[model samples]
Target chain A: MKSESRKEEIIRAASILFKEKGYSAVTMRDLAKAMGIKAASLYNHIDSKQEILSTIIIELAEEFTTGMNQIVNSKVDAIKKLENIIDLHIDVTLRNSDGLASLNNDWMHLEEKNLQYFEKMRQEYEENFRAIVKNGVDREEIKPFNIEIMVFSTLSTLRTLYLWYPKQKNIDAEILKHDMISVLLKGMV
Target chain B: MKSESRKEEIIRAASILFKEKGYSAVTMRDLAKAMGIKAASLYNHIDSKQEILSTIIIELAEEFTTGMNQIVNSKVDAIKKLENIIDLHIDVTLRNSDGLASLNNDWMHLEEKNLQYFEKMRQEYEENFRAIVKNGVDREEIKPFNIEIMVFSTLSTLRTLYLWYPKQKNIDAEILKHDMISVLLKGMV
Candidate 1:
């Protein structure tokens, strides 16, 4: 394989192990073993286990950051913006469900600098999400419920879609997205 | 402390460690250290680390089981039943947010018999939740979205409330429940 594809393959293998055993429990040798390569050869593509983890997590985080930036900059109404945001989550999460377990559960185990960066990105993401909800409430487009609860309920459901979406193989993406919006934004009642 | 209170305290400390390190990473010695007790004394109240984990997880699962049974049997409409189900989640999750981590992330680590039992409880819970959603759709009380998607969306949000609820300390329980019902059952749009 080409060098770039080789690195991608290594990261893919690492994500599977990370998802199963978590970051701390997993080791470079174990990852190499899972990939059917010598440990020394593994080091040729990745600097260290930390580097592999940082790649898996930071790349995925940056994707969200980039997506959220686009959504925030759009001139759409809050409800429209929120729907686009949900679409972004479904798209990104479905594509990278493997890395999501680490994104959700193992980011804290990142080395100090990476940990800080992840935390900052997460904080900013929430602030931007809250802004959308606040705008919706202000425009009376959304109900005047507690903003925190609104954000929490909506975001939490979207955040964990990776866990549920994969099991639902037969459901079309459009159908799933429509149903999610209905249940989450339009309320089931 | 009395024996019963001591057991509770042990479970409490175990939950904190379990939440931070996960069930597989946490040890009996670590639980004792967190509780400021000896490891030998730890065994006096709990049979093993597995038992501590089982107690934390199985008890919570059983509570949901019992709560779902109550809601399923109620004479109320499907929407009311769902609201009651949501209330049960928020109440139980808030009270045991720490244990909720174990319940969500660590149940897979449970030993054979306990693991089987936990899985059984979870399967039944989902079936009953689906039944409620199906009833709603059939009665024309709920929109005819895909039943699995609706249940997945609703339960995923409620299931992960433990991750978000503790952080929002200022939100009152009644307000949380009301907003949740409005956003979930009524949709924000």
Candidate 2:
């Protein structure tokens, strides 16, 4: 395989391993074995297990940052912005469920520099999310509620969508998105 | 401390370490250091690190199981049953935020017997939760959307409430519970 795809393949294998055994428990040799490659050959592509974890988590975090940045800058109302945000989560999660798992579960194991960077991006993403919810409450587009509760309720459910995605694989994405929005945004009653 | 309170203190200290370093990463020595006690002394109250984890998680899981059983057997309507379910989660999470963290994040690290036990309880809890939702749909109490999505959204948010509870400590528990029930059970719109 070409170098680029070879690197992608290694990262993919590492994401799955990291998801299963977590970042700390999964070793470089284990990642290599999962990839059906020798440890020496694994080093030719990725520098260390830290690099694999950083790649999996930081990349996915940056994707969320990018998506949140878009949602924050959009010329849309609060509810519409949230719908767009849900779509962003669904799209990103469905495409990168394993990587998202690492991002959620193993992010605490990120090395020092990457940990700081991840913290900054995570705080900013949450701030952008809170800002949108605050706007919604101000404009009366959404129900008046505790902004933190609203944001937490929304983001926690959205962030952990990966945990449930594998089980719901057969369900169409669009239908899942609609059901989520309706239940989360609209309520069952 | 008395033996019972000492055990509670040990569990509390272990929970903080486990929350920060995860179950697999946390050692008995680390847990004892956090508690300002000797590792040998720590074993007097807890049998092992695994026992501490099992105490933290299995207790919380059983609390949830007991609460879920009550909800399942209640004579209330689906929405009321869900509200009770939400209250149960809020009450348990508020009281045992750290233990809840271990339950949500570290239960997978449980030893064989505990792992199987946790899985069994978790599956039964989800099944009972689903039965309530299914009954709601059949009785036309809840909106007929996807059952799994509705359950996932509700439970995921409920499960991760501990992650947000500490940050919102200034918020009153009653108000927090009210807002959560409103947003989650009644929908934001």
Candidate 3:
């Protein structure tokens, strides 16, 4: 991996602050104070609060988009693709849940071009997910449940893991991955 | 069911406003204007913004508490109890998704005794769910996934149903109930 840049460091700190107080509530001064840097020094590394937010949200959205593209392009079947998607969510959540929080809550605050890009990525992600489910149904490899219901049932849990997983320090990561995939895909029956 | 009182009418309108604007952002003046009543008339039905929030959240929380009590005491097995709990959530969500939005997003804004009461009810609700899942695992009726994982996997979906179910007008309620229970409990594959 490449060495983290100064701007990346500023964005990372801003993501945490955004998670805590929400994007609208957080200011550059608070983020600077949290990083123990002078407020004016922050300007050298980042442009504005909006720039920090767009960076945090857009980067994460692109990361998810890239991951989804890989999984969709892979030779895996529908169930395998779904499992990989779940793993992708877990991997991202574990690495940058604070960033994921901003991605989840503050993406709407993104400016014009960034907002459109993020929304398009999101739309494509859902469509790719839907196609996988639809393929599974067509091939009779998966249950013919309502496509929307199945998608939301799984995605909602995966999406919200950032909020839930951080507090659950006791659950081992491997165990969490194993059990969450099991509970989500295979159900608990 | 009892007839809706004027106070209840005010509370219902306030819940819709709270859902749209969040609890803190909404004001008595906005609510009164929405109701086409003078602001003083709103005072006749409710005490303050705090009271409206408490009424919306506490009443919903207590309603959940009441339903959970019935399921917990029922003579059915753990799986059946879990099914009943799912039905309970759908019932409430269907009846009042708008109110549920406030219950979910604005519960933290509840104050003093109301806050304590809402938290207590919420804690008991989770504890009861945990116990039911634990019982299912012990009886070998449910898979031995991590109890917390199973509990969250199921409850998170149910709790957020209020948000998801409203937009899917093409899906019938009965079909939703059947497919949702199947997808949640029995897996997709």
Better of 1 and 3 by TM-score: 3
Give the per-residue lDDT of model 3 (tens digit) for A90-115.
99999999999998888889899999
Instruction: Provide the interface RMSD of candidate 1 in angstroms, 1 decimal place.
Output: 0.9
lDDT by residue for model 2 over A15-128, one digit each (tens)?
A: 888888778788888987887778999878878888888888898889889988988888989898899989999999889899998888788888899999999999999999
In model 3, what are the clashing residue pairs, if there are any? none
lDDT tens readout by residue for model 1, A1-189: 688899999999988899888898898889888988899998778899888888989998898899999999998999998998889888887788989888987898899999999999999999999999998899999889999988988888888888778878789998888888777888777
Mark the regions of model 3 whose C-alpha exceeds 4 Å error after superposition: A1-4, B1-4
Backbone clashes for every candidate come to 5, 0, 0
lDDT of 3 at A100: 93
* TM-score quality measure for candidate 3: 0.97
- Give the Å error, residue A8, model 1: 1.5
Which residue pairs overlap in candidate 1's backbone?
A185-B187, A185-B188, A186-B187, A187-B186, A187-B187
**Per-residue lDDT tens digits of candidate 3, residues B10-113?**
88898889988898999899999999989987876678999888877887888999999999999999988988888889989999899999988888888878
Please state the error at residue A147 of candidate 2 in Å.
0.3
TM-scores of all models? Answer: 0.94, 0.92, 0.97
Candidate 1 CAPRI level: high
With candidate 2 superimposed using the best TM-score fit, by how many Å does residue A50's alpha carbon deviate from the native?
3.3
